[model samples]
Target chain A: MTKRQEHILQIVKDHGPITGEQIAERLHLTRATLRPDLSILTMSGYLDARPRVGYFYAGKQAGTVISERLHKMLVNDYKAVPIVVQENASVYDAIVTLFLEDVGTLYVVNQKGYLAGVVSRKDLLRASLGNKGLEGIPVSIIMTRMPNIVTCAPEESLFMAAKKLIDFQIDSLPVVRPAEEDSRQSELIGRVTKTTIARAFVELGSEPFL
Target chain B: MTKRQEHILQIVKDHGPITGEQIAERLHLTRATLRPDLSILTMSGYLDARPRVGYFYAGKQAGTVISERLHKMLVNDYKAVPIVVQENASVYDAIVTLFLEDVGTLYVVNQKGYLAGVVSRKDLLRASLGNKGLEGIPVSIIMTRMPNIVTCAPEESLFMAAKKLIDFQIDSLPVVRPAEEDSRQSELIGRVTKTTIARAFVELGSEPFL
Candidate 1:
């Protein structure tokens, strides 16, 4: 909208049901001059008019505004600190960390501090079954290794991260960046999970509806 | 908007940047008589107007329309069929069911088919650790018992269900209905999990933006 259009909108918003002639009077313009502006404003859904009652502000739709805001939300803004375990860590140790952190998934980093694998509760549970010596078994044996892991980048939209979680049917995503030493190796920076998506959904729902 | 207003909007949408005199002529009405309707249309964001260039349709914002539709989505519409296990089922048996159904959580029901408890992969994992005789222990022994379980109703908004998932820090919710035999007992009808919310989020994001 032009400066004059915005001004006209503000006037109608503040003192709406005011006629085109009255609006023109405030703007120091003729009613004929304001005709196009009024017509444009009404057409764009910024105002409402009634026969003999004049123009009034039509409130901005919350959905459009909120949707735009939502689309701009990035994974970097919402990702949680990732929980990591060494690839050599025992299945027992991974399970302990899982309970202590109360997280559904764990990232397995190799000796170089680059992501090597991802372990979920399901993996640990399946490994634990009928196993008397969980401590002896290396977590790497059960972890979903790199190349098979679904990951997200910090700059990606949270929506995209959420989509990854759904599409991959995984509980969490390692928010990663390329390792300084090896481009093929990922440095786990953070995490996006189903919980993150759920939290975002709640926040969206809780925003004051216009 | 009135029928005449809709008609005017359609006309402007189809042949916009057309003058008010032209629109009035098309409708068989004088320009003066159509002034209020045109003003209303412009103010309400249905059309845009430019001085000398004439009026044109201002497209509807997708966000608001999608948001309204999203808010109307109920759990009943998106809930998935629940996977359940009997209360007396062995923890070993529950583990088999969890893997077989490929579900993160399982609802436990009594012989009468009332919701008895909720079990999750975490719960099963915790029980499996350091235990060799998994079949000896009943799942009910480790399950999060009723009255402590957080649940959702079929009529609840998916947003509300998502809220509960985040707020309570749970993996899934048993979508329940009151049992016919006993009003106090809940009958498992469906399930809502983080996956469900993520799927919904993906769908919302996938919608074509206007």
Candidate 2:
């Protein structure tokens, strides 16, 4: 269901047997525009309406708005292409890639395009300041390898994926889908970054009501 | 403008000379529910309607959906209370505050509760690893002092404030309202953190669409 529908459901739950015009007024929408949403709710068994009595809440009250949707929003719906580098790429080249993409983290992919490792700005910064030349040194030497690198599947809920970012205190998570034949080997499909979430939040906040 | 009103404006732009019923059908709302939005748009000079000819688009195309709201969304509308400490507090206390709050950064305030400096996890980590006794050292000694601290006013836009966070590569920004008597001192009213933005985005993304 759309957020609007969920909101409408909440309104009906709070004030059952309310008129369409009243719901529209509360939401600053025309009764006409609210019809589709009203129809969906009634048809879905979440709402009940009578010929002259208006609409009434039919859904259970256990589900809150956020939880109702959080479990269903998959990673693939919003994940974006990630900036990646070969594990063999020099630390110097890794730094250049980081600047070019303007991303704090970079996913290191193997030659076959399989998820390999992850490198961050702090890793590069430490490498750059070291007396040792970074010209030919591979990122694999400093990158956080598999089993240590946190990842999420495309099928996973964005809510869980986002929680991982916070729990790990990382800026981004590589979205990987299982290989067609082998479930053990995951292919990097996209990325869910802090910026992506932040931009989404800003858009959400602009709404008159949640 | 609320997202719904924007949608109505967009619908009018894309399919002008459309009746209220048509708009209602397109949005699944009833005519009565959509009246207020239509009225607001018409009065705001964004839309034009005739006696029986239906609504027409009157706004320019260049001024699109986001920019119109971006410029007007004040920080005061979304800012939250900031995690802060006094400059005279020990580095040990600052470290405790950082872990206690589970925040990436901490705002250091003076005796009067004015923002004095900013301390980050990296700062605490470095201080803790040093041989010097953290109890003897004040947070002000290691914190990023004023003139170096990047901040935003409660009057600024979230878009502009968000840009600042990305441009500066920082995790949080202190939301300050300008002082009435002292131009040099700005009162820290709240904070705009990347996590705050992230949580918002996650909520936004969960919605089917605006």
Candidate 3:
């Protein structure tokens, strides 16, 4: 987010029910410029912006407001659309689907749509070269096992997901709900990849309207 | 990295002793088409090209081999040197430095050159609005504590540095020596930021060398 965006949040937090024009003036930006950001935060379920009225810090103000864009871009937005691949699919098929989708990784889920093991391009490629018949071998043979799988909570920020990819040196992250009290598998919610983070960063940094 | 680059790595990893002709035939690309990638990778230290023999992987393979151009572009190789502010400096001074440097953040270091904390553009802007006395307010009051700082290893991948920024929701990550068991503070090294990631991504995704 821009420095002006942070200042806007602070203003709304400190002085609620303030006009966009005032914030624009204070930040040396145009109301037209601020409108889109306000709309985005509102759409992401953070700040509440009202027409002819003003904006207010909403839903655990400290956590949301400005950085929600950062958070949403990380994991929440990716979780908004979950991608699934059957656990029994052949490794080659997974690779094909990956390339076709232009994604660096794919999620392997159980029949119930719960997350099983995760597979990535590197894993699949490595498996393909193995003497083992990859055409007959299920992705399970090469998949990154549960617990070894790095995941992100829906409420977590994009920064967190990006962190996982970087720290783990993996290309993608599976977005999953926390596992049930006693269950081994976490709910398969969605997926996020390095490209997702890169795209979001571009999106946020891009002055599309301007 | 592009799919072709990855394909080459996979080829080397799968059949290390294989020749360039074999890879070109395997990928169905003419040797001429692949020569540029080979030259680029070899020049960047990702691959060691033998005069008669084919290319072989070189150095430590870290997850993936992003091009040196991408590395230089994304890690802010040109502008990543950390900007230090003396420990006793006021938040106002930090603001002037940030503006002068055209950077999003600055580091706070003591007389002994040990890292104390960090002051970001957002922090300074927030402090600026708080009160007239902010000019006298020590940066330590507003800076994120040192022990809480996120960092990167020099040998780390660009993706790793990106993770620190995204995960912490902080604008900058100081690269540091891994802290010792008994110690709390890490030795300050270099710095990474959002702009670095964006620049690198753009370069990596762009055609031709950056």
Measured against the true two-chain complex, the DockQ scores of the candidates, in the order shown, are: 0.21, 0.09, 0.01
Top-TM-score structure, candidate number: 1
Error of 1 at B82 (Å): 0.8
- The CAPRI quality class of candidate 3 comes to incorrect
Compute each candidate's TM-score over C-alphas: 0.73, 0.51, 0.36
- Chain A in model 2: its TM-score? 0.68
Candidate 2: residue B9 Cα off by (Å): 19
Top candidate, metric lDDT: 1
Tens digit of lDDT per residue, candidate 1, span B1-210?
789998998897666657899999999999999999999988766676766657766544434444455677799999999999999999999999999999999999999988999998988988888888889999999999999999999999998899899888898999999988888999899999999998888777665432
Kindly list the per-residue Cα lDDT of model 3 for residues A1-210, writing each as its tens digit.
666666777886666546888878877888998887777665544356555546655434322222333434436755436556798998767766765665546788887778888776546544543234556778888888788888887777776666666666665677777567636668977777655665555444333221
Cα deviation at B88, candidate 2, in Å, is 17
Per-residue lDDT of candidate 1, residues A14-120 (tens digit): 77657899999999999999999889988766776766657766555434544555678899999999999999999999999999999989999999989999998
Each candidate's number of clashing pairs is 22, 19, 5
Error of 3 at B176 (Å): 29
Candidates, ranked, DockQ: 1, 2, 3
Candidate ordering by lDDT (highest first): 1, 2, 3
* Model 2 per-residue lDDT tens digits across residues B1-210: 889999998897677657999999999999999999999988765676655657766433222333433455567877878999898999888877876776668899988888899998666655654235778889999999987999998888777777777678787899986677787887889998877666544443355433
